[model samples]
Target: MDTHTAATRYIGPTGMDPIFNRIANWLPKLGIDVAGGRLLAVRGRKSGEWRTTLVNVLTTDDGNRYLVAPRGHTQWVRNLRVAGAGEIRLGRKVEAFTATEVADADKIPVLRAYLDRWGWEVGRFFEGVTQDATDAELADIAPGFPVFRLA
Candidate 1:
């Protein structure tokens, strides 16, 4: 299944996505870091204006940084697809990078590592899969979770 089809079939935004996004967006503006979270700004594919959201930035053991869409194909994910690049800001510090979507097949380790660090906050979105889940298990849900590598 393609990413869009797979995403629509699984999870979308939750009731709390907006509530938490608002709070998360506010924190970084005040110089508060919520577990490595930052404000991601990408230009809207249609509107051409920058859209912002609070996102969890995951850094793996190999020093690569990633952004995972635990909420499936969200607006930010769709926007990033068109923009191809964006900025992540924490307080006044902003880091800009090009974004490359990680294929569903290659998302295993990235998803696992993301779960390991942010599972306490986002585990429920994975439908009971944990960081300890086997490769096969991660693969089953891979299509539903869109991942990106920041360059």
Candidate 2:
């Protein structure tokens, strides 16, 4: 349905500040959600074991929820691609569902909403882009940020 071709250009993840990353993951594991943060667990493609990580969940005006990758094409993105489903957990409360990659051309709105919500925490990964960025700007950065619609 998208007129734009899928974006193939990938930007690898920047090194996260280890202490910050750990605390972020720890809080959610302890059942405290920080500004839309949740623990996402999925089966690893190679290990076939449950892998968990911190993710920010965004629910837009139209009620559609999504998980946007601030860091480009990371391990979870790769695993989800193969697994096709995962769980979004808030502590012991786990919601299992299928995941579909949002086509690059169609990621504009989702990216915008994600930045609007998590920009302060994840703005570094966007390379100067922001929620207020134009459609073209968002489009240009879309491919680097993989998005998933959780159903």
On lDDT, the candidate that comes out on top is 1
Per-residue accuracy of model 2 over 108-131 as CA lDDT, tens digit each: 989988888889988977878899
Error of 2 at 52 (Å): 0.7
Badly placed stretches (over 4 Å) of model 2 are 1-16
TM-score of 2: 0.89
- Best candidate per TM-score, number? 1
lDDT value for model 2: 0.85
How many residue pairs clash in each candidate at the backbone level? 0, 0
Instruction: For each candidate, give its TM-score against the true structure.
Output: 0.91, 0.89
Q: Once model 2 is optimally superposed onto the true structure by TM-score, how far is the C-alpha of residue 65 displaced, in angstroms?
A: 0.9
Model 2: pairs clashing at backbone N, Cα or C within 3 Å: none
